[model samples]
Target: MGFDGPTFAFHPDRRAQLRAELDAYYARLYGLIRDELSYILDPADVMGDDYPSETFRVLKNNELREFW
Candidate 1:
């Protein structure tokens, strides 16, 4: 069985909100990663060279498709 009710619809305003939220979420995640890893690695170097794509992959693999 699966969900069978009034499904949520995505609207433009909601899309904008989600985008902002996602940006902030990633920014915070980056900040935390940087702060914790500074002693072992260069945050800017890791983020610039690898983080974006890796983050995208993790999100996709985890099926993080909804934001509220």
Candidate 2:
């Protein structure tokens, strides 16, 4: 739950190597998206795989309620 700048296994009282891998992956992802993502996405309602939609009308008319 913390980002310390060191490449080593963490969590002193733990029982799973998987968590360390996941933590490392998330740290990298967090670093990657720390700035770039905010510019491309709206501050609100950023959900699901709907991308590059020109407008909501197209989304609605296409019957993409499930995706929306």
For candidate 2, the per-residue lDDT at 51 reads: 50
Estimate, for each residue in 1-68, the C-alpha lDDT of model 2 and write its tens digit. 98879787755346236645665577587785733443333322344346544334453445455433
Error of 2 at 52 (Å): 43
User: Which candidate number has the best lDDT?
Assistant: 1
Each model's Cα RMSD = 8.3, 14.8
Name the TM-score of candidate 2.
0.24
Model 1 lDDT tens row, 1-68:
99999989869677778966776677687775545444223344555654443424545444455532
Give the Å shift of residue 16 in candidate 2: 1.3
> What's the distance in Å from true for residue 44, model 1?
18
Poorest 10 consecutive residues of model 1 by lDDT? 35-44
lDDT, model 2, position 44: 29
Instruction: State the lDDT at 38 in candidate 1.
Output: 40
